[model samples]
Target: MRSLILVTASCSLLAACGNPAEEADDPIVAETPVAPTNAVDGMAGTYEVVMADGTVVSQTLRADGTYSDVAEGEVVETGSWRADGSRLCYDPEGDEPEQCFAGGQIAADGSFQTRDDQGNVVSTVRRIGDENMTTEPTA
Candidate 1:
């Protein structure tokens, strides 16, 4: 009789084993987003930022991945830009932590939006017109 009770209890425990297929997909699996390559190239040009009061700041960016910001007849920011796989990096002339890569936007209209490493938009630069740059001897 004890063996019978033990067998009956084991059978009851097995019968209460709950349902399968509680989940459909693997919880451990996740998807990651891919970044674009030439987000900055679309912004390569001389942009003039017009403020609310109509103030302007001009910036010239080269295709070689170098940029210069001119304000008050002086260059404030000078840096080289490059792409690391899917990331765009902006490093100063040398080893400096001021490099911006976290959040940057190059609009289709040649406007630019710079952001910090945390992806916060810092500055907005708009394309005014073609630089029409020419080199000649200064008479």
Candidate 2:
């Protein structure tokens, strides 16, 4: 009958529409790799700190959170360091105040710049050796 054919056609159309919930049940999602959020991971190494005045200081950032600066083969400063988000902060072992610098991510060539509060570059730290190289050999 005409009514039976119409009902069959309507059922076919409804079935072809499919269920939204079923379609979303097994979606093919793409996974993206996450980058490191802490800048300290790449910061523990020996670097040459090139100041704005063209003075170069050899600095070492240890994995134990301590740091030391050498100028003309002498240790001029010692400090403790920490990373706050993408910023690197240093607390010197004296009357000196703590200093924090932005732009802590090192580039592919193992160099990164430190920016002051006014977004001016204060120094460029370039990695020259691994952190282990600064450590004394154990017996």
Candidate 3:
């Protein structure tokens, strides 16, 4: 009986050690966005993003403050965005993330562009009301 009790106690201890319920998983959480300092945020109020080539693209800024990317004649991509310090940052497609305020571009019309230091526009984001702009911070 003593040996059986010891074995049971050891088994229970081992089972507890190996159990996966120790901690819960963290759900996807988005940070709050910072208001634009200049006219950038104000200008960002629901404007179409015009490429450097002058091709006007359609995107919507939702009342919920999310951003979306619209490919020509394709479906829209919804995303989330927020402020990291003073820089504007966001994640896209609920996947890879980006930021514009940190070195990001708030277009003349309140649209956000993620650009490289060389001024190459890597991504252009328009607020889609429900989706927010995505931000990728560069070095």
Candidate 4:
């Protein structure tokens, strides 16, 4: 019958427009690169960061291209650091990849700020002390 053929065609069209296997349920997010700012030389020092959840993290950025992160006086992570122009790059141990931050700014009050790949201020650093001195001070 003509009416049965029309309904069948409409059902076929609706099925064709339904969820495709190639389409993902969640949208893919792209990270936007931020413009580099401030040099990494002056940032070589110990910093204490208060995270969004009030978690305090201590980080030491050495001048010899190394860094260490301590939590509650215990070393949690150690890695190497470098400067990709004005951006600060950190390469962690094992299979973990490197992360580079842009728009780095160090304030006179010892506070610092860096932007994520999306140009958002996701990290705040405050200098707590000078670089570690390996040599024993002569009394």
Candidate 5:
């Protein structure tokens, strides 16, 4: 009788197991997003920033991933930069944290707005220099 009770309990436990077919039908899967390449080329130039307090600042973004942020003809910050889609991410040196700007709208007259990560317009940064390096003909 003891042997029969032990065998019955083992059979009950075995019956409680999940079905293999059900597990196979409901398999869990995860997917990751892919980032675009060569998205940073469009923003490689100098930008002029007129602050809310009426102070003008110059931010130069180079293609070699380095940037120089100048204020009042003095270099205030130097850092590295990258682009994710239309957004530009800056990683400044020292204790300053990284910030991202997006939603840029450039016009034919070489003017554009630089927006923050929340898609809000932080500053209207103008394109300072000639984007195309063309020399005038000398007579």
Candidate 6:
């Protein structure tokens, strides 16, 4: 009886150890990492800015902190930009003071609006492309 019990236990252990399908079915998968959330990450791209006066201009926000505004195929303005939470601030190339705008939550259609202090819409910005500025390598 003891020999019979030992043989049954040994067969059970071997059967469990030899089953490759059970191990394959329950794989040890590594967890995928989550990306950090930042407002500037979404803002780095080309956009079409429509002012409240119905004037339209093309703006490009580079990932390297520089930006340019093009109007009528001419570079009208060049600036450096930064974001503080949801607020976006721009410092133009000249002696002009820094201009900061609030409300930068981009919409599903790649559109967002900048608002003034009194909750007025300053401009409507729509993303036109996904091309971001990249710096060239130095030798």
Best of the candidates, TM-score: 2
What lDDT score belongs to each candidate, Candidate 1 first? 0.40, 0.54, 0.36, 0.49, 0.47, 0.52
Q: How high is the lDDT of residue 67 in model 6?
A: 71
lDDT of each residue in 1-139, candidate 6, tens digit only: 1111111112211221223443455555223333336545545666667776766666667667777676667676777777654456677788877666664454545455666546666676665654454222223
Q: In candidate 4, residue 91 scores what lDDT?
A: 74
Best by lDDT: 2
Off by over 4 Å in 6: 1-39, 104-108, 133-139
Candidate 3 per-residue C-alpha lDDT over 17-81 given as tens digits, one digit per residue, 9 for 90 to 100: 22123222322212333434632233232334444445544444333445444446544455544
lDDT at 39 for candidate 2?
43
Q: Predicted candidate 4: what Cα RMSD to the true structure?
A: 23.7
Ranking by lDDT: 2, 6, 4, 5, 1, 3
Over 4 Å off in model 3, which ranges?
1-44, 53-55, 84-86, 101-114, 121-139
Name the lDDT value of residue 85 in candidate 5: 43
Q: What would the TM-scores of all predictions be?
A: 0.45, 0.64, 0.37, 0.60, 0.59, 0.64
In angstroms, the error of model 3 at 92 is 1.1
Ranking by TM-score: 2, 6, 4, 5, 1, 3
Candidate 2 Cα errors over 4 Å, as ranges: 1-39, 104-108, 135-139
**Count of clashing pairs, candidate 3:** 25
Q: Which pairs clash in the backbone of model 5?
A: none
List candidate 5 stretches off by more than 4 Å.
Answer: 1-37, 130-139
Candidate 1 CA-lDDT value:
0.40
* Candidate 1 ranges with C-alpha deviation above 4 Å: 1-42, 49-56, 83-88, 102-112, 131-139
Per-residue lDDT of model 1, residues 1-139, tens digit only: 1111111112112112211222124343223323235544333455554332344445555567665555556565567555443334555555564343322334444344444346544445454433344111223
lDDT of 6: 0.52
What digit string (tens of lDDT, one per residue) describes model 2 on residues 57-94? 76677767787776777676777777655456677787
TM-score of 1: 0.45
